[model samples]
Target: MAPANSSAAAQRVIGFIRRTQAPRQSPPPACPPVKKYKSLTEIMAKARYAVVERDDYSDVLCDQCGSGERPDELLLCDKCDKGFHMKCVRPIVVRVPIGSWLCPKCSGEKRVRSFSQKKIIDFFQIQKCADLKNKCSSTQDAKKRKRRTSLILHKKRRRLLPFIPADNPSRRLKQMGSLASALTALHMEFSDDLTYSPEMAPRSANHADFENGGMQVLSREDIETLEHCRAMGRRGECSPLMVVYDSCEGYTVEADGPIKDMTFIAEYTGDVDYIKNRENDDCDSLMTLLLATDPAKSLVICPDKRGNIARFINGINNHTQEGRKKQNCKCVRYNVNGECRVFLVATRDISKGERLYYDYNGYEHEYPTHHFV
Candidate 1:
């Protein structure tokens, strides 16, 4: 027998106990889901697709230092198909065969071939020159270059053949080869016909005394002596023109050659060495100049950048008592020595192998190679 209000309170306690007894479930997690990654090879595989569109490459790895770095990061060799950084290889032009660019550890191997017992460098083989000859061809490209070169050579010969001091006609060539000496000898045959006497021979074989081969430059006092030589003949001295060995002629050549006196009717062509030969003893007495009767041609002359050739031509042979213009080649006789050697208003841009010659001089280096004799 319980009171009604106490009965209601007992029922409330029972309900609270039931609620507390129920199992507690765990709260849901707050973090996001985990992710998975592809392998390194797979990643690199994707990169290749992007890189394939780029240009050519050598090996995938560096060849020089054996580094594993990619080829694009290194300097690549075109011929060998290898890659190296600029620093990893020896300093040389990457191109060209004679010069070699070697890797740091190329097994201590000699990289370049030997020429004349020396490592080939800059692709030049000087000793080979005597044995070497121009690789001539009948190809259009080769012929065009050859013709241009020949014309230029002919022009230089015309401009410079007369100023050689009467010593050895190409004494310099005797040391070089038989070919050049032949050219010198051929050029001098015209001398006898040209009116110069031939006392300046035998000295051609001597090189040790080559510098002292002829007359010293005429000093101021020498001018008085030259004047005396001219006056020795009497009254007015031999004509002012006779004091010098010059002759002038005019003709039109390629405007691309050297420029010179346009008014005269005779000219000279190249190789200072040739002119030096004429000035030398052997041919000096025997040589002569040739000219054209045609008015369409004129004389021309060119000088070295130093202008020494021009100066020597212009210098007074005090004994002869003549200065430059007075010694003009136009003053000489025609066809007596051969073809005219002068040109006027021609151009001067010579080709790479083309010899840069002048009428009154011969090459320091002789013909054939046009290299230092």
Candidate 2:
């Protein structure tokens, strides 16, 4: 220890000695230095759970914009109760359809009072108006003229009621909205027509274009081939299916009415094998069936006459309930002398040697055209 009062130079040397004697801490562990992600999307990718799907995954994507379409960050409108993105909102106006602006935070008693006193319609009110209109149209009561005319006041009810019965849950407005949305989504899909692979089907696609009048019929040979081949048929080792020709277009035969009486349908050969055994098969190499000309326009097997293959074998029935009810196909021909008919399903255009295809369950209800097999 220095004397009671040390000199300034001596005091400075003592302070330096004390500072050097202080305990040193272990150096802290270094975290791997954070590598910066390149893009804004990459930086915010962790928030994927919060993001909405802008379009279906398989839809054609915009290279610059990533997966999203005309989508924006979600925003709830204060006035209209309508859903729109933050970017889609229109400019502020003096008056909106549903009345004065009030966000969820601002939905106080005063806002509710303003909403009610004003004549603006709500989402539920629209539904009510729709229901009233439907009731007037269905009842068709001239004496109740007010019900027909007062659609606007009951707009919500009228909109809900038009297409089908209320008891049928499937007919509900929400379900229809979902269906419309789904159909709109389908429009985004790249169609087979737009995305054809030429290497895989050059001649075939061109031929279809020609035959369907999407292009000119290429030649007279093509027309002749179309008609001859249009008369399609099938042979059978398992099921004998004769697609007798007929036409039932531009008309819907009533539920109880006769299926045969309706215009055009093909006739079948009354042969027992054709009536009970023709199976529908589509292997291209071996069996070739020929179309027969007769009161019963039938099909034939080229190689054996003894069937090399089968014809139709599905739910579509051979004939009308009045004519025949063959399991697999019972007797297509009820009367030995009279004609028996078989209707065909035209999924594809039948060319020569391509086995003629038909359904066994019933007529081609899916395609509005049905003529005799």
Candidate 3:
């Protein structure tokens, strides 16, 4: 009985020892719980609801094509707050533009077009000047007084009208066609009516020379003299006037466009010496005589050192009928603000390109060209 009890106790002790010493295997992990997922319809409903609630996107997207996957493929417009993809834009850009980007509508692409060259014609193709043709076939008596040899044509006429239709019409047309093609190649437009009007011509080209364009400032002595003359009920010579030239009228003086009626043109700055008769005296023949002031006392003004542009005025030889019609300007001695001043006042509205002229002494038989020289 003692052996049987001891054997049973030993068996229990050995089992307990084996159970404590041996490595125990962990129970297999319980099967993972089945994950519950929403249906496709429910997912789509949620996505649509989110889009309806917030119409704007959180990430930067293209306004043009609604593409946002590629950040580098977008171009922002400078004119408008809109983004566009490079592929969706008209005239598609291969790469990003460096400067500000303007959409097709913002940039004036269709408004400008290349000018056509088929509408232009030669300058001389219009008509031949009647005045030149008439002068060519004038009487010998008319040619004797005012010789046609003295008529000096300007060089600008050659540049303006290089072709004469009478000489070679076919060559002239060919040259005009060549000029049109050349202008077209250079991206230039040539319209009809090649003549330059007053409004069309540049304001700077109206003056004789840029150096003698504006009005000169009067000296302090001249100002004092002006004031003194004003007190004596004479005219003053303080005005903004300029000297301009034209092909027809030769050298003439004109005031600003706005100035009219009783404007001071220039001052005769010579010494007002009293001569009994300027013809009898040993004075130069270029002196202007004031005869209306005093009969016996001939007030002669000879501008040797101190002279203005008024000295360059030429004598109008109106012996021919054409000369009478060509006169455009006139000189007058006026009491300008109390100073005695000789001004070249416009008899009519002086156009911008029109030349200034006056009858020197009103004796139009022969012109004294030597005095002006």
Candidate 4:
């Protein structure tokens, strides 16, 4: 009876131990099934817990001079709340203007119209429309259907194409600054569009100045839009961009607002000279306008003395991932009006305050960008 009691007690104790350990030995409740994320943005959205709002202004300083002196004289940007001294800003605001004023950065953003609202057309289309209008008469009933079909086709092709400059004269002057004066002193004229000199023109009647096989011809609608842009450009209006002086990168162009992919930013404007003449040139912003089959006929654009916002744009270091990530714009050589033209175009959607960077060497990878940031 004593042995039986002892065996039963031992069995009871073992059973109790097994019951307590059963929960721990199980498979961790199957781990609640891991979530699969489709994109980095989704993961970021999930990881974010809360947002902290900033209400402090004790550390405000002038964005231009980096000084907080004469706080009353500092003009706070209505959009960004960044402070800037009246004298430090371009054009030197003598007194506050009548209405709401935006800083250079904010003003740039406001100047750019949304891509959805803007029209992009081809140069050839304008010529076709003008030719048709000159040839067609109001009595030609048969041509009406053809014209209607053409108009419909053009309407279908309408899309957000490129940037339009601001119409405000004061703002335009401020953006151009002393660039014209500097160019004039160097015997160069500031041009916002490509110019063809006698040397840069096609040498022979059969010699083609540009390769247009891959490009699309512009429609009449596109021509009207281009004309409007040209008129604005002639008035010293520029793309919705701001040139900010960086201590490290010198001067860099920044997008004032969101920009869509393939949006035409600016034409690389300068004196078109033979490549042979500029082979030993020290100009860092030289752009290849044409690479003719004949080496002697090749032309390059020298933007050292006269250029628009494109000259200030920095190149990206394609070797590093960080450097490549910084690139938002691309340099594309387009054939416009039987002439080779270089244009800076947006490669991806660019956000406000982001600096523009493009591959300087393009596919050839000739230019060294090791020190590019």
Candidate 5:
């Protein structure tokens, strides 16, 4: 009876499980909708650490003008990719550049050109004051102006002192004053004094007749070139080169003794007389300076009729051929843009108020010893 009862209970439990178990239904459609959890990549992308780039680009700010670029228009440098205001460009870029655009800093070339332009303007302005000071010397008002101008000049001079050669910096002013005194004491004849004479002719040293010869007129280009020389001297910017009358040296050029090499003393650009078969004896004219010469290359430059202050440059007679007493400046020829340009270059360190002289002839021969001193 116990075994039958246990079997009945097991059947009942099995029947109950079978009744509770539901029949299996058909599989759901392949495209059935379901709630989906985000993938690892998608979740990380949504996280704050993920870098997501937007479609819209922010406007760039100009480095020079310090202005942000407009959404519609902006100039970008092809090299540095720095944006710049179109109007802020030097020379003011009006139209969009056809090709690659470069900012002032990115271009690198404009800075130098800009600096040179600025320096030239400053030089001319400085010269205008200097000229006024010299002209207004007769009046009391002029005296006051001179004093003010001197103060301005003194500051510039102090700055330029380092470049100038002076044993005693304090005594440089005194020495310059003495040099001026010495030069003033010497009343040398100036080329400007020469007057036109219809029947003038070149004569010997004893009876030189500069008046008889017709004045050599310079071309428009030559006049413009000389203007540059005038600015250099009057501006007192680079070399303290000045034309002064020296009793012993005659009319000569002098530097404020600046420790400068290859300093442009003066630009000798005028009617360059190119002589192919020219001899040294051919240089009979008093003002003809030998510009450059090789075995076959003989180029002479005569600045008598059309020259800058270079025409007034006197020669230092190095009679002894001693290196110590040689001239301070040299005549150099440069090939510029396929054109030969002549310039007076400082050869060595020059002292303040020192007379600048160059050898007329390359060799140290005393051919014109009588004319020198």
Candidate 6:
């Protein structure tokens, strides 16, 4: 009887403990039911109509050239309302379309395609096409008359040529040093040629009037060579130049091979920004791109972030005779297709293993180069 009573008391204790303990948590509430659509087409249709807001085109400018002149010639995109010149559109729109026309951005079509897909402007192709046509005409003329042979060996004019970059990618990156990282951080990409931002677009005194800008126009041969160099640069090829570290001068560009006079070393390339904006900035590699008559319209190329081998080339102390003697390249600004572009040309024949130096202040002597090495 005593053993039965003890067993019964233990059972009662266990029952009380189980009752006092907290109840098990209920399963998580069922997720709300997902709305069902008849088909993907129905969902897409709803999405398309969801965006009801329309862009304003009251004072539209050409999206390509960013000019408001000749408003009659501008074609407005039906969806985004962005304006573009008829001639600027690819497949050249001669006349306004009968119905709604969409800009490249609104239509989801790429404005600029890869080089492999399109031949780009006829800038380089013009030379080759002309040469072929000339050859055909010369052959026909020869058939009609006897050809005269001249024994005089004429000297071929040496034009600016593109730089052949180092074959090793690691070596190229190593030579670039902190510039590569700086470019990535600034949201700027390495470019071999000048790039125009919205603010730096040609305006006022630097407008697209090529003939009236008092800018130097390049000859046909020179233009062809320049275009070729630009294409090579876009493809990541640079002049046979290397960057080396110096204790005093920091990074300096050295010729990997003998560079002839009038050779195109590299273009001063970077984000073209207004001078007023960068006045307080501490960038050391700024190059004067355009000096508009209006002070507000002046622009400068900041190459500390985005630039080619040209950025590494140190400046010479023009005040010193020795500094002037070390200079082998000259920076010249030219107007290409109504755009201001800076090119570094060999002022004299540059020897292999020689460092390149140019005047920082140009002819104005505005920049102090006394401390330059």
Winning candidate number (lDDT): 6
lDDT minimum window of 10 residues, candidate 6: 144-153
How far off is residue 38 in model 1, in Å?
70
- Per-residue CA lDDT of model 4 for 22-113, tens digit only, reads 86654556667788999775564444311113344456688988987776566766556567777676534546566556787777732222
List clashing residue pairs in candidate 6: 163-238, 163-239
- Candidate 4 backbone collisions, by pair: 121-222, 122-218, 125-218
Q: List, residue by residue over 1-373, the lDDT tens digit for candidate 3.
A: 9999999999999999999999989989999997554766455545544543563544656776677756667665655545667766554454578866776666754422222333323321233335754335433323432332133123221110010011243433443443334333223343211122343232222221221222233344334433432221111112323333333333344432333332233344444444443444532324443333333433445443234444444445445445656555565443333233454544554443344455555532222533331
Write candidate 2's Cα lDDT for 1-373 as tens digits. Answer: 5674578778899999988998987889989999787866554443332332344333333232233344333333333333333222221111233433433333442212212211212211222324676445534532233353256346643211111113332223332232222222222211101122333222222222121112112233222222222221110001111221111111111111111111112233111222012444221111111122331322222111111112212232344552232222221211111212222222322222222333332321322212233
- Model 1 gets an lDDT of 0.28
- Please give the ranking of all candidate structures by lDDT, highest first, separated by commas: 6, 4, 5, 3, 1, 2
Q: Write the per-residue lDDT of candidate 6 for residues 231-289, one digit (tens) a residue.
A: 54444344677665453355577887678777778778887788878887767778887
TM-score, predicted candidate 1 vs. hidden true structure: 0.15
Cα TM-score of candidate 6: 0.52
* Overall lDDT per candidate, in order of appearance: 0.28, 0.26, 0.42, 0.61, 0.45, 0.64
lDDT of 5: 0.45
By lDDT, the better pick of 1 and 2 is 1
Q: Indicate the residue-level lDDT of 365 in model 2.
A: 34
Candidate 3 TM-score over all chains jointly: 0.28
Give the count of colliding residue pairs in each prediction. 78, 61, 10, 3, 7, 2
Question: Residue-wise lDDT of candidate 1 within 245-268, one digit each (tens)?
Answer: 111111111111122331121123
Q: Give TM-scores for every candidate, taking all chains together and pairing residue i with residue i.
A: 0.15, 0.19, 0.28, 0.50, 0.33, 0.52
**Model 3: worst 10 consecutive residues (lDDT sum):** 157-166
